[model samples]
Target: MSTTQIASPRVALVTGGSGGIGRAVAERLGAEGMAVAVHYAGNRNRAQETADAITAAGGRSVPVTADVSDEGAVTAMFDRVQETFGGIDVVVNTAGIMLLAPLAELDLDDFDRMHRTNVRGTFTVSQQAARRVRPGGAIINFSSTVVKLTLPTYAAYAATKGAVDAMTMILAKEMRGRDVTVNAIAPGPTATPLFLEGKPQQAVESLKNMAPLERLGEPVDIAEAVAFLAGPARWVNGQVLYINGGVA
Candidate 1:
């Protein structure tokens, strides 16, 4: 049977759905016959484009705008999803920012901004999902392979993902009987606008070759991992699945 013929329909909220990985995940989930709420912080146009593509392909979707770090905004976004779809079955927190600088040269303000979006944003979204997501649902968070790679100039960024890893484990245990699986996906050197912006061709090539696959991961690669956790990987909970083609 095709995904569209699945007996039960699921609803998913993918934050940062305007960008590369998040948009890919949203589109993939929509193709799986899930109603998707594509959440964007500031790019409503891109979000709408994602929703339109999903709808045109015979899936249901809507674009939502919210600041993930704002408690009230995130809450309202969740409320909108619940009202639109009855209940949320999957929540993917892909909204994040990366600021690169060696610890010694990093601006404190930059560090704070990263923490606000990457760490606090995940916490706020996870809190809402824990309270609202239905049984047998999944909550997927985004981490980074840099957390383990320990690359210089990524200290601030990796710190935020480390917090994400910690939260994923704790949230999984907290929702012990809720039947909601929580996990994080760590992608290495993906070809996203966020990753490519301001990067030199030489630097990009170096990162591409670091992986055993000898290529940078695509957004679709990470989306496939998310689809697994969201659909059939019930036993895989509270772990960070590194989807970087063995780059760790």
Candidate 2:
């Protein structure tokens, strides 16, 4: 008699998996043959939809929830992923909030909320990922092209992403001997609910025309980049990939 052994699939925990970009990334990774933990802050149904889609595609997925800025909650999210999938190989931090206003007029409350979600949330998730992601794993964080474009009303949001850039670089070095990679993806003008929420159609068209590609990014475009970094781009570490279609 002949015997064969099966290898376990890699597992991914995608924060904000209920949202547009996050959902695309979760599904993309799931299609790549990894079990996925789809995380949402509030909308459990949407997260479960993402998971269900993955499962329907003949992949493994589960919906998990947490407030990314809360350390205890984030810890439990990781625990849940591990309990469901056995181990984590990749973590994609797409959970963030954007509040745009001129630097002088930006409300302090808005700043605090943005900072908590974009910066503290990434920090909390990165901390846990730093401790737990297995060897040869990857940690992907979200940044924004506003940091480079220096858009006037985006000062507060850009500041948060700048912090993420700093943390990503340092974390890559800190994981020096661990064989894990840390990187950030800075996407420009993606047409997600978050980006399109408050903008007028004319303003949206202007943004679309700004890019050399003459179009706003799709969530799948960002997901494609995330898939590359999370899977094959092992040497592409400690870097911020600007996926802006030359808008900068």
Candidate 3:
């Protein structure tokens, strides 16, 4: 039999699947027997590596590319996935950018750049997912616990996530009776390249100690939450789940 014929009926499109946390979520969904569409903004090679890993582990996947902030590009990516896998059962939006500066010192241009990717990207993908995902599916978005922490340099970044949290709840209600759950995962101080890029050892240690578990969150930790919401968490709609190890 052909691989596509034998593949699982479920399909998942994971945006930013080349990144740390996103890659983990994609692989976990793949392991759950869902055919995955790994979406990358630019790094097709890394995305393909993720897909290859999934395929090696007995799952089917393809690497897709698009700028998540562009509605047309995102829609095209979704269309391609549907054409390949029949339909989408889950949509996970994990593409985002973080630029830290105190509100007083932050450049408006930096804020706009972050918002364009984080807020606009989530909105664009969620819009497509709402229109396309099959019932009994899910739309998982990325948020940050920093919204509650209210850290000084994170004002602009947190604002973007605040929008995400608000949108998540409203989208859940908007999808009423559609059997599709909309939720956001708010992870705190995850040890991804994006989070660790320029931070010194001391800063990283401080964040690790803040969590009661006394360690930085791993990509797998957040991925486990994605797997839950993507699958059997039918009743867990319209909530921003904080996977920060008791940090917030």
Candidate 4:
């Protein structure tokens, strides 16, 4: 959709905006003329670069930092955005961590750490979005296609995303009268550092062929899906969009 489609300036908070998919989402929203908050956890410089890119494109943006799992910090992040852009109209919770391990080999500490940022972080951010996002706004949470793919070494990561899926469905119901749409985007085998970090070359090549598209998903591919939900897809609430190029 064109930037002109947005009648008024909408504000968006994109968590993990320093990272691959999150950066794409932030930039896409900015291009749509939304005042964007490029959120980061530790990579302040990268987040600033994202914000700078948006501003250079003649869009309004700022870099904000917060630990998504911390309610107080998340709340503060929201306040900072509101103070800067007036009010939040969209929230894309893309701040997540992925640790791959076979179920039997996964350490409890790894499981807990992964869940802390993935599950708890999404919940905390969604909770704030539920209360703070304006009417006609949206809450876009991130899930993974692994939930359905049932990948062997993705047990813990998939479990966290499963929790996200459940929360998104129910949150939509809870927002019935609020006019705020809630949904999740599940992307399959995206080409991001998080996905490629420890994977062997052969394994990566195998995953690329899983989809009929014959390629790993791109960050922009996921961002395009987010743009739809954040802007024009008002009737598409409570759905889990699987944007995996026919990979079921």
TM-score of each: 0.97, 0.97, 0.96, 0.97
lDDT (Cα) of model 4: 0.94
User: Tens digit of lDDT per residue, candidate 3, span 143-194?
Assistant: 9999999988999999999999999999999998787889999999999999
| Cα-based lDDT for every prediction | 0.94, 0.94, 0.93, 0.94
Q: In angstroms, give how far residue 83 of model 3 lies from its true place.
A: 0.5
Error of 2 at 101 (Å): 0.8
**Error of model 3, residue 7, in angstroms:** 11
| lDDT per residue (tens digit) for residues 115-219 in model 2 | 999999999999999999988789999999999999779999999999999999999999987888999999999989999999999999999999989999999
Give per-residue CA lDDT, model 1, range 120-223, as digits (tens): 99999999999998888899999999999999899999999999999999999999877889999999999999999888999999999999899999999999
Q: Assess candidate 1 and give its lDDT.
A: 0.94
Which whole-number lDDT from 0 to 100 does residue 112 have in model 1?
98
Model 3, global lDDT: 0.93
Residue-wise C-alpha lDDT for candidate 4, range 1-248, written one tens digit per residue: 22223326999999999879999999999999999999999989999999999999999999999989999999999999999988999999999998888999999999999899999999999999999888878999999999999999999999999999999999999998888889999999999999999899999999999999899999999999999999889889999999999989
